[model samples]
Target: MPTTRSALMVAATAAMLAGCAKPPEAPPPSSSAYRVYVTNEASGDMSVIDSATMNVIATVPLGKRPRGIHASPDGKTIYVALSGSPIAGPGMDESTLPPPDKSADGIGVFDVKQNKLVRVIHSGSDPENFDISKDGKRLYVSNEDVAGVSVLDLEHEKVIATLQTGEEPEGVRISPDGRWVFVTSEDAGTIAVVDTAANKVVNSFKVGRRPRSIAFLPDSATAWVNAENDGTVVLVDAVKHTVVDTVQLGERGVVKPMAVLLSPDASTLYVSTGRGKKVFILDVATRKVQASIEVGQRPWGIALSPDGKTLYSANGPSNDISVVDLATRQVSQKVKLTGSPWGVITLEQ
Candidate 1:
């Protein structure tokens, strides 16, 4: 037996040693159930997919030329952009306008719980793409033909304001903090950063030719803009509001690129080549093309699952969505849909 002082010292040392030891290890990651929604522009319908089973659960009819799509933050509602007059945009002859389609030029609000379109809120002329604010109270709709961004009040279900932007704006994305909205001008080859609170274009930066879509990195410190005309992806620094670098994807003679999506981990970026029929997987840190997987004819719209394990590419001419497994970087499944698929969104329970 040790003396009282010696025993106390031993106990103190043991306590300190125990406190310095590492904690037990954490469990490995696992998969979770997810749902994928694809908007078929040709079919005028939406395809619902069970991500776990990789099967189509149901197909719901939507408005004409349904292109841009987004799910509510709480996953309660899915807003689909509907263009009644498909040929209303710039450079189009007014005489060519198809008989007015009542369902066009508005947002089809689908109640996710009910699995149906609950309401149609008129946004403006030719709503192409849209983004929801961080607080989920407002929606920014990029009306391509109208050359402006329409601010929709979700609670009021009405357009509160419309701010003029560049001609033929195609992509609209809200900043991570929901303070700014970035809209891409396909015809102008520029990006207009709008101040959400002020409802005005605050900054405009020149990017690659025909900038169509935009995606931000995980940190939101930088964003990437896909330039279809130049076949390059321009990286924009968020704080400085400038193009830091440009990554060329394909030769000008090859094909035009359409959409850009960043992996959930921010490790890789996926770009769909509209005329190339190939999806390019790029390493974010290295900015190198890691793999170029052949998808389908006229692959335009692209999306990734919430967990970042799967990728969905909408091939317009093929009229199907190619499901790519991120881990293996292979085409796991091809989900056939009605007409030309344009936009995709993933939902999780």
Candidate 2:
């Protein structure tokens, strides 16, 4: 009888200890557990798409010509470039269009939680594209019309410095090391390297004809930039600001590379060919084109899923985004968007 009672008490004590023990921690969320945000240039609004459903859940109104979109380091805020300059296509007469509205030219600050534009930062004249600092305290913006790069202080909400770059500066990228910011000038076909510490243009080097966008490797030692008019991607030595090699995408005048993005592992390079209507996948080691998938007309902006299993391309003329599955090298779906989809980015929810 005593042995039986002691066993029961021991079992009870074990149960009590088990109940008091801490539970196991929940696993981290997968990459798809997020939302996709796209900027529509023609509609002047941002489309919020649920990543899982791949449907447009909300449309947040922004100012005129919202193009470049990027999220803060914490993914709590979004910054979009709002331009009032009339759309002047290549060779178009700017004198025929309406006068630029200076008031609408600024960077739209958006609150992710509020799902609205909280404020507008007066970055500079004709703010087209920009890249935020690693600390999210500063923004390096490219003023296309002004032909300069403006360094804006997020804390003060003002432009601290504006350094003259090449003509028609459009693409702005900060190196992975956070030491230099690179701006691409389409007309000049050159890249202007800015020293982040000094906020000055330290070097300018020609890459190709009409360099459009740039993507840097994880180590920040190498960079890949697209030369639109040349129909090629130039491999650049990030440290020296010099071109090491050029990989011809296609015949000039037919294939115009617009945006370049590196894989998470930096093993593959993706190039979105504007007007070429296709996205080319290339092996970085061999610098050889592995495959090409026809996405849509004028695919300008490209982004990869967090897991690196999927790719999304913003088709400006088609008004849709191509969702590609990297494993099969095929487009799995096309998410339609209102107006011309100019830029695309994914953020964790």
Candidate 3:
């Protein structure tokens, strides 16, 4: 019974309302694919490589000396360690040294979506390596010079606690359950196990000379500490907090093992020998070297893909990443970077 104009207006309004209705929901993310991020220390840049393509898709510029790199558990952000320390020693004192021309020596936060460095969170002095809590609420950063761990609250983006550790803490890792943090002391040759809830060092155990890197098995029952100077990997039982076994990788004075990585299934362990220029694959059950692949010179960091089909080693002197196919057990590809690539991390989207 409405007039013609009124009828037309009503129809137009109904049509507009229909158009404003929500569209169909977006499909979920592809579960099969992922990305890999590698930090180049000398180049001051990071390389973003597509897992499927094995090609460098983007290069993100970060602060000077971007070394230790880690991806958030959600795969939403990448944290890189930017050291402002002097090339010779820990440069002049922070107060006396000239202010940084750009970003300071801290954690460079990169938003994965934008592929850019979004912020630099000031950690303690000489933030070398770091680890995030299992719940993703806290970040434990190892300040090498300060000889402690700076616990950063992710939600607040500030350092809330600094727990004193051994001398020259180089590698820091949180347990899978998020209850304990293990820090390796390069100069002290010890590992400090921190109880997260209590925020205290529960125990400190002796390791080999210069414990530079640490890795835990998937079950979280055992951990492997790499002694760079001793050329050995010490296996520690987490519960007992004791060294259960020590597997010698290279000769007493020949090889230098820098980083340790476990396979996705936790059946194999991989160690990068710096002076040997080889990646040693060890069978976890037997604690013996199963294979050794000659990689580039001075491989400092190593990471395995999600599927455990590929291994990536960052060769410092070669300034390239050696991609080894797990099945073939050889270098499949070497991706060149701008500078010395040290920290390599794989991301599954």
Candidate 4:
């Protein structure tokens, strides 16, 4: 009798489940959802490109010299570095140029869904570039003119701490573990490794002449610094806080490296040579340049998709974005951007 009751209960439960409404299937990804955002530094604006159509849909005016772009880890917001510091060349005298409009320095925050500039937030004077924490609670900003990095609290939009750095700090990168931040001092030619918890420069080491940009591995075990003037990529051991090796990008005075990008798996690296007009493919284990893909002239910033299928480079001199097919290692398209493109970031829906 007990077995019969158990069978009856099972039958009743199955009948109830069968009569219940079925769950709906998830929809496929929309083709037009992918987008590429390019910052035009010289134009003081940013252009939004629709990747599906390969056409620029809109250009939003930002403050003076919009550069160094990065999206929040959640992909809901984008932050761009904006500055009004007088633009002076290498040989130009700073005194002759107009004083940096400290008032014009700020970080522009944009809403992804709204497709509009939400507000302009100021962290410190001349926020040239910055890196947001994984939790999106903080931002480490490299103040180009001030020779330090301003750590800003995201919720309040105010600088919480200032970490001293070398002269003319330009590039700021945070480790995956969030324990350290590596800042490149352009004029000082050194990397200032900061311990975020202590909010101070923990270690400093010479990389090469004019280290402008840097990229780190997923494990935070190694980092690569772009030695622009020397035309080489100096590899650094993050754990040891030392320069492990140096890999030459191109000939002297010809291949000025502007940026370094690591693959999703950290097995390969891609370097954008500024004057070389090409992106070099590197094998991680061997640390050798396997091949070079010719991109537009003066490629400055580089970004890769989540799937690592497509690569985008902001070509400054040519005023365009070179879309490269990583599988084929060839230029698939050149999307024209009217202004001088400085930095680029892409999001795939």
**Against the true structure, whose lDDT is highest?**
2
Least well predicted 10-residue stretch by lDDT in candidate 1: 24-33
lDDT of each: 0.85, 0.93, 0.86, 0.89
Q: Model 1, stretches more than 4 Å misplaced?
A: 1-32, 87-103
Q: Give TM per candidate.
A: 0.86, 0.90, 0.86, 0.89
Residue 294, candidate 1: Cα error in Å is 0.7
Q: Candidate 4, residues 1-349: lDDT per residue as tens digits?
A: 5698899999999988987767766753236757889999899999988778788888988889899899998999999999989776556788898888887798999888877888888878888889999999999999988899999999998888988899999999999999999999988899999999989898898999888888898888999889989989989999998889999988978998878988888888888988899899899889999999999898989998777888999998789999999999999999999779999988865
**Number of the top candidate by TM-score?**
2
Clashes of each: 3, 0, 1, 0
* lDDT of residue 42 for candidate 4: 90
Better of 1 and 4 by lDDT: 4
Which portions of model 3 miss their true places by more than 4 Å? 1-32, 88-103
Give per-residue lDDT, candidate 3, residue 154.
84
Clashing pairs in 2: none
Error of 3 at 72 (Å): 1.2
Ranking by TM-score: 2, 4, 1, 3
Model 4, stretches more than 4 Å misplaced? 1-33
Please list the Cα RMSD from the true structure of every candidate, rounded to 1 decimal place: 13.7, 8.5, 6.0, 9.5
Number of the candidate with higher TM-score, 1 or 2? 2
Worst 10 residues of 2 by lDDT: 24-33
